[model samples]
Target: MRGADKLVSDSLATAKRIIDPDTPVLARFDSAFYSANVAKAVRAAGVHYSVTLPQNAAVKKAIAHIPAEAWRGINYPQAIYDDETGRWISDAQVAEIDFTAFSSKAQEEQLAGRLVVRRIPELNTTKLAAAQGQLFDTFRYHAFFTTVEQSVLDTVAADKVHRQHAVVEQVFADLKAGPLAHMPSGRFYANAAWLVIAAISHNLLRAAGSVAGGKLVNARTVSLRQKLVNIPARIAHRARKLILHLPTHWKWATAFDRLWHNTLSPPQLATP
Candidate 1:
């Protein structure tokens, strides 16, 4: 929390410089980054932010104020399949409240934002029974604090965009499974450099897949390596020409040929 303000501010400032000034930028973070300083930094950078808030007395109190009608059923972009239950689970609700935060701070430092909350009912036997036994239905709440104004974006739209952060998580998951399998060196700077190199390699592989222009465009790094990067080839030279022989009857031969021709041949210009 101490240096988070500076980190977020600097990152956002850099983003502002790199992107079109008129393009609206929104930063999204999970509960670990929930802090007044971070929110202030986001506001100062002229960017909107949506950060998950840890449940506390004030948050619970705010949830209590939301009317029953406010909660609207929303579908997950992709249905979550539960192996244990052998079913596709897709039931959740979302709502928002106009809330002011950091009240304890001086008037100048206090911030006003929306408390956007998503609640999933506890459907397990024990929790369901507990809910039936009590007057209230048991629910697990996931709420975020956002500075995005209602006029610019509504609650549903903001939540939808915030959920896009999961794509970043997928990239991290891919990295850990591939290039980041080992820390490489004991030195801090060496490991840091390795991480940077890993990211660059990952992007280069992704670009290669895109250039291949097929299912490989969305293929994982390991799959791309297996198909395109690691195939065995034998080289022979005769009459000042080199011939490379790949494995016969290869399954990915068409895709490999496409990649080869597309990469080796320059794009043809259209005649006017």
Candidate 2:
């Protein structure tokens, strides 16, 4: 999905291309992008979605409305107290309670008050033995937030979104393993060409892995080429003018041929 400071209209337009009214719940997990305004864009797609609310005054005010009794034993992410800094960390517990319907039915809005267990991760380490005493530290807080219902805190919806931040991280993993890793340069056209090539490679890799063979497979083409392309062979003269001495049995030869044909073959002309 397109991110950054782009308006919700852009997100909605992009969603319009693929999303239909029949789409089920779209579980969106974003820190800063989910709000009543953004919720409108998703509602336009006529699908149910849940996302992390930003820690702003509006959300905080909504959270304050929930009674402390509802938050009794709930914690966000589970974090142990830090004795040195007296802070909770990287662990928390949480609870959720839906608001009285805000937007329409498909675009429902909810509020939750979560007991966030956070961390004060001030790591003090030294490169040299002498510098151990003069250590620089970093502090971090771990917490969870929710809007599901208080009665069902143990259920999936209450804590599942916080656990799935890693999925978004995986998208960055794909970007780093692709064209976005480096800054393009030289002339504008050259950089554009490079980006075009890298983008094509990335898309082809994804298409080959997920959509090509029915089920998505882990042995994607990117890894396949890295492993197979390095085979060493000798060019020689045989019964004919020239021949290439291939490996004993090329397992990927068939797949490679299919890939080449699909890539180089001309587009099929449509019949009038």
Candidate 3:
């Protein structure tokens, strides 16, 4: 579980089994998972990967080489709030440059990719003044390494796709909020098994929500459990038939009914 490179290889192999051979796969990872071995594993699997690259000396050098005209303006449909700067940023400039990653690694191990960079105007004048001279306008830069071809998706599209990695963080947050709130045992295997069960339960809840449709489709696990699973009802046997009575005027009753019907409703037979 600790070796990210091995995990990436094994995960990609598992994905290949489930996904069609012709279908393209793209893996996204945060800066923590960025490494020469990880990138090599992804490349060997013949799939594209987008990884958040730490702005180190070499990366800064490559970024510096980008021409002024290369930066194109982009505006997010919904403004993103920057926690670091404490500003609502709606627009930024994005550019890409041909770059090589893991240059310190062996020649064969070095991975070739594009460095897609986005820069937002530095709103904090106090810090900006200390970081750079007043002669130039300061901007905070965010960059990522991606093997996705420019023809398939331009810099802006690739940046958008890379940003979607935040969705995975939401999943982790959901897990922590629910079954993963506490480790049941001190043993590593016990914790691993607990994680597996938690994942399965999460998937089941998501599937149930999808079947139910409506707001429940995107509802969090907590909300889904509250609205559907934790219900006050009475079950009784009457005239050889099982009848369930739910509380009157209960909220989310329709959503529950939809889930029930969608799951248990008889399938229609094809006409001869």
Best by lDDT: 3
Backbone clash count, each prediction separately:
0, 21, 0
* Candidate numbers, best lDDT first, in rank order: 3, 1, 2
lDDT of 2 by residue, 1-272 (tens): 34432465566567667766455434355666555555556556454445554455644555556554544343445554455555564533343444432333343443333433222335433333345454564333333444434464443344554556655565556656656687588688887888778768766676554432333345544464454345577899978777657676776555555654666689789999
How far in Å is the alpha carbon of 178 misplaced in model 3? 1.4
The stretch of ten residues in a row with the least summed lDDT in candidate 2 is 111-120
* Sequence-dependent TM-score of model 1: 0.78
Where is model 3 more than 4 Å wrong at Cα?
A: 16-25, 75-90, 121-139, 232-250, 264-272
Q: Give all TM-scores, in the order shown.
A: 0.78, 0.45, 0.75
Model 3 residue pairs with clashes: none
Give per-residue lDDT, candidate 3, residue 114: 95
Winner on lDDT between 2 and 3 is: 3
What is the per-residue lDDT of model 1 for residues 22-44, given as tens digits with 9 covering 90 to 100? Answer: 99899998777787798889889
